[model samples]
Target chain A: MIEVAGLKKSFGDVVALRTVSFKAEDARVTGLLGHNGAGKSTSLRILYGLIQPDTGFAKIDGVNVSQDRILAQSKLGVLPDGQGLYQRLTPREHMRYFGRLHGMTEDMIEQRSQELIGMLDMGSIADRRTGGFSQGERMKVCLARALVHNPKHIVLDEPTNGLDVMTTRKVREMIQELKTLGLCVLFSSHLMYEVSKLCDEIIIMAEGRVAAQGTPEQILATAEESSLEDAFVTLSERVAQI
Target chain B: MNILRTIVAKELLDGVRDRRSLFSAFLFPFLAPLFIYGLMTLVIQQNTETESITLPVINADAAPALVAHLKEAGFIIEAFEGDPEAEVAAKTVELVLSIPIDYQKTMAAFETTRVTIIHDGSRNDTSATVRQVRNLVRIYSSELNALRLVSRGVSPKLMRGLQTENGDIASDEQRAANFLSFVPIYVLMAAFVCGLGLAIDQTAGERERRSLEPLLINPVSRLSIVFGKCLAASIVAALGMLITLGMCLGAMLMLPIDELGIRFSLKAQQVVGLIMAILPIPLLASSLQLLLGLFAKSFKDAQSYVGFLVFIPVVPTLVMNFLPFATSFWMYFVPVFGQSIMMKEILGAEPVPLLAYPAAALPTLLAGLLVCWLTSRLLDQERVIQS
Candidate 1:
């Protein structure tokens, strides 16, 4: 479970997040939907303990991030905004490195690495260096490494942003599997259809604030729109007017 | 500690696989020794060449006795008819001996005569040969004076009012060590050059690749991460320093330094002393590199900054070389300067005070730690990741 409350952050004179609050519970895929520059990444970064909010707090499993960042971070698996991999490292090495950082023993690292490679269908390219990997292949490696420690809560920032059709479906399926395993998965994206299909609950952000948030049925009823896409457009426009 | 170890292991593996880092680390160690060999060979060749001089004499026929004297002194005489000044000015000959046409007349009249040696005073390459010829002429003149004094039934000793001799105190080893004094500077430079690529790659290169964010997102302390990176860079740098030291020892062993009229040999203790003097420098160098690298916005920017930072070791070396100062105890507290002085002492076979070793290393290690601490603080700043 990940919880962010009254998060307010600013970069110089420009505010990045203003009064943003949301909760992503265990056993659910919670989607943070916003347009570019709508503060989704900033909110997620705050939740992952990478950024500190000026006001309010983020907590992982009720452990306050600001008060105990390391303990909070240990419980969270992060596929950050830019999933940068060491080009000279193989997929298995990547998994092993992150696993070690999480203080996993060698045997556990090896076991978890094999399990991730199998689940991600990355066995063919598991031992090869990531230097020449395709975009989809790199994404798989990033996801596998993030999941290596098997944290209770997972945060992915636009995980399917640049993936092709088949890789996109694979990622959606993986998220579904994580949800079924009773882990809290919070992801941020600007894609309406992906969010509508994958998320058990949706949080719409506009101008650094939460514009609307609920289950799909509740969100549609609140916006008085038939489709979720139209509801998001209408709700964001109302927030912009206000 | 385990996190630090893990970070160190990962960085080392990453650095070893980077061809650019490996190339930078190994290139200078191999080349510095070859440079020493080439330089020492050139000095030996120049010193040996001075023993046999080729003399270009204008009007050689006018001074048969003088020419014969020069021949007995092992001067290969070549008669030249061209203008002596122009020949020397053009560098066609090192120097010219002009025997005046009235040279025999003055000698027959028992009067002092002049033999002008035409040469460029500013040219150092031919100064030794010119000095040799001048000495030979002075000896011949004194001999002639002695014979004249003997014919007059007076002792030639009466003509010598005072005799002077030189007492040089420097040992042959010391002289040879002075010739290779730049060895210490080369070794120090290796400390800086070897880890440059890796240091920049791990810090600035990490930022440019956008990997720092993800790495920091892990539950590792910033200090552990920074220290780990610094240790990895220092390891490569230490390897470079060792290779350079080994190659220098090999070069000293292989070169015919004795041919240059000096004995040059490094004892096992002195080699050990050299290693002790330089061991702490790589930590200082890599930590400094990491600090500066974190400030740079990109890999190329870090490279340019590091290129400028290499001058840190060189500035003290140049200052010490050109404007020598009296050695004081406090000098050891300064990093490169102190190490350089210690290296000089070891190379010269002079006894170094045992305290001097830690005096040099402690400050360097402390400075390294300080820089690493500052780098960790920089890592905590949000701008470091945002940029």
Candidate 2:
């Protein structure tokens, strides 16, 4: 389980996140929603220990993300935007490299890579350099990089942004699969339908603050609407009024 | 350790693959010497042209024998119609030889009659030609004195002066070879140039690509991470210098045998001394470059910042020319200054004092490490890395 309290972060005078707090509980998909400047990515980045919060902390299984980030991060996998790959590395080489970073031996990395390749259907391109891959292909390779070590949580920011419908389905299926394995998955996205379909719980952020947090049905009911689309419209309208 | 190996492997693979490093590390060193050397050779050949000395004169010597001998020694005999002063302004001749009116009369009494030779000092070759002509005139006049003494029945051997030729043993080839101060300035340059691409790519390239975050998230010490990258950069730079040295030695050895009379290539000991002197320059340069590149935002930013990198190697070379710093064994341990002095030593000059090499080099290496530590601190700062 994860817990966050009073997280604050800023870039110079412009605050990216202010007094924000949320958690991705064990075995649940927590969708973080926001408009362009909503701090979802910043919050997720902080939670993944890729950054520090100016005034608070997030913990996974009681281990502080800020203080023991590597330990906290070792318990989770992160696929940051741009699908960070070394470009020159083949899929197997890339997987082996990240595995080594987390302190896995060559044998262990090799063992884990085989399993991931089979599961992700990435066997065909395992030996090909990631530089030549399409956007969707690179994303799967990145996902494979994160999953090779099999962390208990996964923090993916806009993981399906430029994917085809089939690949998008493939990625959402992977997230569902992680959730089934009792992994705490925090999904940050800008699309309302993407959140409504995949998330058990959603947190909407606006102007460096947490605007709302609840399940899809509950957030819809709070907007006094039936469907997620109309509910998002109502919630945004209310946010504008504020 | 595994992280370092992995990172180093990645760096090497990337470095070798980069077209920029390939050019700077392997290609540039070869072409640099050819262009500079070829250009210098062309200039020297054009400047040192040989031609006969032209002597414009009004001979006042009563002995016509002296005049005949002088003309035979390759001096173009131009008999002036009037005063030497009038000949200069009209530009009738390039030089004027003004022999005293009673030259032979004074010579009979063993009193030397001086000749005033005039030529345009602004013309570079004129002075050399004038000096050559003066020597010929003296020698020819000396020959007449010997003949006059022989005719008068005085001992000819007594008038014959002692003759000696002072010559050094070093061949023209050896002198030319030794002329190159072996200024391992190239070594220092090799270090910086080789490290340039690696340093820029490791820090600024990561920032530009937006991939620094993922690496930063790894639960490793920031110092460890920086050390790993710095280690790779240092190695890359050192390798570049070695490649440069190889090309330089190759070029020296391949110099046409007939063109250069002596072995222009460095001796094994000289090569060792050279390598020893410049060995640390790359380490120091790469460490500093990495630190500087980290402050930049992009490859272009890193490259522009490197405009200042030129100062690192140049300042020492420039400084030493004015302030004569004695080379000590302790000095070779300092960065650029040590390397520069060591090169000055290997120029077939005196060997560097033993203790002074390390005394100079240790502090420089320490300073390099200190700068690298500062860069590590910058890596920890979010603001610095983000930009």
Q: Best candidate per DockQ, number?
A: 1
Give the 10-residue window scoring lowest on summed lDDT in candidate 1 chain A: A44-53
Q: For chain B alone, what TM-score does every candidate structure achieve against the true structure?
A: 0.92, 0.67
DockQ of 1: 0.75
Q: Model 1 over residues B1-387: C-alpha lDDT tens digits?
A: 888889889999999899876985798999889987998787777777743578999899989988999999889999978888988999998899999889889888988899999999999888888888999999998999999999999999998899988787878887877787777878888899999989998999888877888898898888888999999899989999899988987898788888877887778899889899999999999999999899887788889999887777777768877897878999999988899889888887878899999999999999999999999999867787775
> Please, what are the lDDT tens digits per residue for candidate 2 over residues A41-60?
88877887767899989998
Q: Note each model's CA RMSD in angstroms.
A: 2.5, 6.3
DockQ of each: 0.75, 0.41
Candidate 1 clashes between residue pairs 3 or more apart in a chain or in different chains = none
lDDT of 2 by residue, B1-387 (tens): 888888777777777777765676655566666655575465344344334555667763454665666667756566665665555655566678776778767877878767777666666535666667678777876776787788889876896578678687865444544444332556567777777887787888877766677777666667767777877888878887887777666655555433434435456887776676666666678778888788876679889986578566666666765675554455566568777766656644355665655665676678778877888888767766664
TM-score of chain A of 1: 0.98
